[model samples]
Target: MISKYQQLRAQALPHNRATLMALLKKHGIQSLSVFYSGSGSTGDTDKITATPPEAVARLADVTVSLHQAKVEVLAGVAAHALIAEKKPALEALREFTLAWVEQTHCCWANRDGGSGDVTFNVAQDTCRLKHTEYYTGSLHHEYSL
Candidate 1:
């Protein structure tokens, strides 16, 4: 049987790739690498590669699971940036995730599909999922694994 992540990836990957490309061009980023979830860096991320598309394609893959119906990039809302629409920001996030993926595997997204997660719409703006698990009953508590 196909896992939830696999199914979502099949549905989202095409749009995600398109959005990622737009973001890469917008940022003028020539190269992308990462210190992903469980990996160490050699500290060699300063070199420009001149080809992000191919580079991104060659990057690693992350298998995150989303069970909800929507997701969105958190940067715009998190940084309190003024975004007229959410699509652009979501694309930007896709680009960043691609960069991350290039360096590791499995982004480990929410399976419940919260509002702060990443979601894209073909006819409308991207949707923002919510985060409901792993709460410690604190308003602004920060925790990391």
Candidate 2:
């Protein structure tokens, strides 16, 4: 049976890929890599680390660096949405990586803690998803009183 995450992944994966491809094409970014890490009991801190650090810095403001360019998701909204959202910053690149990890690796990838990197080779039209799950353990002890 398909679960909610499966259903969402089925619908979201293609769209997310398409969106990312379009953005890359628009900016002439032949290849890109997005690094994501999430760790928390309830998946509280999840984020996409700027590959070169300057990639996103450049995206934030075109004037910051000539190599870095900004891609506006919506006219009035934040410009970083192309790479990350505002509230949780998990939309474009973030969503693509984290969502895939959660769907394929572990639905609790973030909740239980995991980290990975996704590399996109546009010219080859391929993407690599690599991740490692952290150790999660609990002790159950009971005594009759």
Candidate 3:
């Protein structure tokens, strides 16, 4: 049997892809990339770039990479707390992605640390999401009298 997470992922992937594709086409962007990085005690940072840099500017206010879209989609699904949730995966993902491209200010250290990159190739109909997380370790100290 497939897990709930897997089921939600399968349902959301196509929707997320379509959302990105539509955004790219609407902005006349042939390709786009989003870079993200964060570290402990520091904060997260992200940058969005497109084939025609000007096209990126055309996005106006709402823009997001496939990675962020998927993350939000899954999060929304999980938050519903039921498989028979009212919000469909497609609509949830579209809504989330269209609302924010990157977080205004976030501390990754709060959840450890992480970094990643996401790219969309309109011509190739390809989307790639890569991510790496950093785990924290504890240190021991001793005192002498």
Provide TM-scores for the models. Answer: 0.30, 0.57, 0.52
Off by over 4 Å in 2: 42-58, 61-90, 110-112, 136-145
Q: What is the TM-score (0 to 1) of candidate 3?
A: 0.52
Candidate lDDT (C-alpha), each: 0.35, 0.56, 0.56
Clashes in predicted model 1: 17
Question: Which of 1 and 3 is the better model by lDDT?
Answer: 3
Q: Least lDDT summed over 10 consecutive residues: which range in candidate 3? A: 97-106
Tens-digit lDDT track of model 2 for 12-94: 57666666655555555566777766667434224444344444444442211011113455767644212222322133565
The TM-score of predicted model 2 comes to 0.57
Candidate 3 local lDDT, 1-145, one digit each (tens): 8555445545655656686688777767898777666665543336677898887667665535442212235745634221322343324333333222222123443467677666788888887766666887999999999
For residue 68, model 3's alpha carbon misses the true position, in angstroms, by: 12
